[model samples]
Target: MELKSHSPFIKWTVRLLKKALYIITPILVVSILVTVSYLKQTSEVISKSQNEAIWFVLQLTKEYSEFIYQLQSYQLGTSDYNDMLIQYEILWSRFNTIVNNSLVEHLHQFEGSITEIDHHFTYIKAMEEQLLQLPRTKNESSLLLLFKNDYDDLQIYLNHKFRLSSDDLGNKINAVSTLEIIFRYLLISTILTGMIIAYLLLRESRYHHRLAMFDSLTGIRNRLWLNKKLDKLAKNNQAFNFYLIDLDGFKKINDTQGHHTGDIFLRHVASRLRQLEQPHCFSARMGGDEFAVIELIQLNTSGATPSLLPGKLVSLLNSSTMISGKSLTISASIGISQFPTFAKSIPEVLKQADFAMYEVKQQGKNGAAYFKPYSVSTMKNNPLSSVS
Candidate 1:
């Protein structure tokens, strides 16, 4: 069977689900964006640092060759000796940056490579000293050539070692990439699970809310909801009539026919009350074998009596009910209490109505009466049987 779309709980659940989704969606999106941004930044930093270290090693051989060319130019009187001195200072600064300033230089393998570079620099410095002393040596060109060749071989060896280290960095980046993918999937899954939980909690909250307002057995408004309506009307200063009803001989019915039949009878009473399609009329099953109602009274200029709704209600209760194909007649004792006419407070009105209904019971069942402030003696003696 197709379900009706008029369920308040389902409507509320959908509203709550949408609200939760709205709250969490942006947070999850931002979190993933931040994570991806951080990963990209880390990758860029690692790549930049590794490339810088490799470039420094590669530049060393070129710097040495430049120094030799500058020296030859000085011998030929085409370059000043000051130019060669500046080149030497620049080369030494580059070497210091590779040895001490680079982040990758702290590794054990890098330390050995640095030591070898230092040894090579020491031999180069010794050759520069010898060339300075013998300014016009006949074999200067051949000696410079041999020095350049040895330094070129050292540069090639350092490049190979740096390539191996760079390969390791590549492997680490690959691992980080894998972890990033896995983390992204897990975050998405967690977000989905959280949404599911929110939906379930919304459903639970709606169920509890319904339980709080409606009667569990007869599906009418319960005592708590009825009390709330009474308080609201009293606070608003609206004139209304309150009715308190008690099922007469309900105990006898339960004893003879069992509690299950008693339950069915109560449901039947609730159904009859629900059929009253009057404006500003509300009915509630206060508890077992007892009910209450509130009907707003619109007074005319001629001042006709307040609606005789309570009398009609009592008549309905006195009608026969068909239970399991057997005609069973039930009667109710009803009491009337009017707002502002009797008292203003909701509790006082309820108390007066209850007393009037008890008076009906005193005069026998199947009747209704208006509340009157009877003395304690009169209450004991049924001297005032003002039933209508």
Candidate 2:
């Protein structure tokens, strides 16, 4: 029995799939990691910006309120003019801080907010001298009223800007969250797809292994399996008898009944051989209409000896089978060879079995023979030697 190699196309396809898996797996992992890292960084930046904007606006509003409180206290004669001026200076410094601050500058870019704040600063600077001379002016109340109106306007502007900034930040956070969800699902899908591909590849590999070791048409162990078993038994120095069975008149059946019926007949034959399988015996399809069986020879324990297997196989194969509504009768010529006895090597054992089977074919069509060294001389006399 000889083992056949896989087709070139099959080999190439498997290699290509393996390479694709190797390449795609790492890329998928990297893509998932990068996407997650980017999302995290973006979220952190947005959060920091939100916090800074909120803190800046709150502090500015608080300083403006304190300045107004000081001015009112001075008008009521409860605080000195120096205190009011000091609060005004503090408010002016807050405006200057907004101008120099990077985060505030970024916020100002959103809606020309920088221009609006600059206008307010210019108006405050124009009123500064009058505000300083407020205690001696006769119309101090009117000036105070005007100043309060301006303060209200500034408060309104700051509130509006804060709301806008909050809404914008909220929208960005929502967008980022959506993107994160999409990326997560994409990552999961990619992982699942990779698993499925890996599972399919594993299944395909197992199928190829089965094809290499078993006969497809007969659904039985193949020549490669038989060869492996022979090697193992030979290595262990186990005494066993190898039987090579060839169907007689199989070609005539194929010629008369077509190949389809012949295939059905062969399957039936293989099924019969399967019945011989046990702990001590194994059967395999050797190719075409040839089959082989190995039976371990136990000299002490015996219900049926190894020598009786050939006769049993001959009887089993001789039984008539119904195929394509026709009764097809076939017989077998079995050749017997012993391991580590008459033959020491695998090739020699197979050759001796083949010779003995051919000798059976020579002696009429349906019989069995044991291999003997002297039988080699009778090979030239048999005309049917080259038929198979």
Candidate 3:
């Protein structure tokens, strides 16, 4: 015999798995998000600091280049260049600002720049003191020739410093690249972890939701879930088919066969009900052997149920057979209640179905019944081709 599968356990496992994922997903997401944010801020800081350093170095190089170009006309032998002294003092002041500023953090590192800059100015300062005694308008081309030599000497030293500073900048840029790579990898790892945690968190959420709404024993919607759905349906003012199926003589199975056998019977019955072809049927456990199915779509209300399909709901219970040996027979006394036909309220509808189920047992066993007023229910108790 092909053994029947246990549905409640399978459904519960699926729900728990989903819930677990929910719990873990968010933590991963937030962590990755935080990492990406930190990396962006760090990259900005490093870039800004490096820019300030490069700007200072370039400023000194520009000033030195200009100073060297100006010296091309100077002669040092016979003339004192009075104008050159004023220009020299101004350039020195500017270069001092570059060296002394707090923005340039490491100063000793650029010693070549400092010494060469001062050497040229020291000689110019001497020239200026002497210029105070010479003619102002004369060309020092002959006299300036010596000044040119000292200036040339300055240029060679400045050039070497420029190369060193450039190398330093290149190395710093390399540092930026390395830092960027590290940040990128960190960000990637953070994102991956975040995704994993976020997934777990989401699963946890769903699992809790399932636990809240489902019966652990029967794999059917619990009372809480049914109430919620009923409220929604009522608010929408929609019509649906409702059924109450009570397994006849289930206590006999429990008492004679043991509780485990009863559980197996319940699982067997629940599993069979789940395989019904009706798309709109949803089953719920109203505690114990009482189970309910709600046909959310057009119901099998062939007898003029408003906005619902026409068909008797009798086969719903008859269609499922309990697992008995090669073929154990499971029978249900199905009571069907409809919207408007029974009562408009959810409670009233369910009560009518419950009442109708016992009504069949009163008449006879092995039959389905529709709840009708005691005065008018002539419909046979034996299961008929869906209530036409």
Please give me the total number of clashing residue pairs in predicted model 3: 45
How would the candidate models be sorted by lDDT, starting from the highest?
2, 1, 3
Write candidate 1's Cα lDDT for 196-229 as tens digits.
8676777767666767888878878889998888
Q: Residue 234, candidate 2: how far off, in angstroms?
A: 3.6
Per-model TM against the reference: 0.58, 0.64, 0.66
Q: What is the C-alpha RMSD of each candidate to the true structure, in Å?
A: 9.2, 7.6, 6.9
Candidate 2: which stretches are off by over 4 Å? 1-38, 58-90, 96-130, 137-177, 232-240, 275-281, 295-311, 340-343, 362-365, 368-388
Tens-digit lDDT track of model 2 for 235-344: 99888889899998999999999998998888899899999999999999999889999989854444225365666777788889997678999888888787766779
Q: Write the per-residue lDDT of candidate 3 for residues 1-388, one digit (tens) a residue.
A: 1112444564576567656656655654665566566656655654664555446556655564554445433444332344455445556666666555555554434545556665656666566644454456454454356655775675566555445356644665566566567667656765675676566667656666777788777676777897887778878866776767787777877787778778877777766666652666677777888777777644454754442221233444444444455334545676667676556898888888878778767766456666666631423434443343
Count of clashes, each model: 0, 0, 45
On TM-score, the candidate that comes out on top is 3
State model 2's lDDT. 0.77
Off by over 4 Å in 1: 1-76, 80-202, 277-279, 298-305, 359-364, 372-388
**Per-residue error at 30 for model 2, in Å?**
9.8
- How large an RMSD does model 2 have? 7.6
Please report how far candidate 1 places residue 239 from its true position, in Å: 2.7
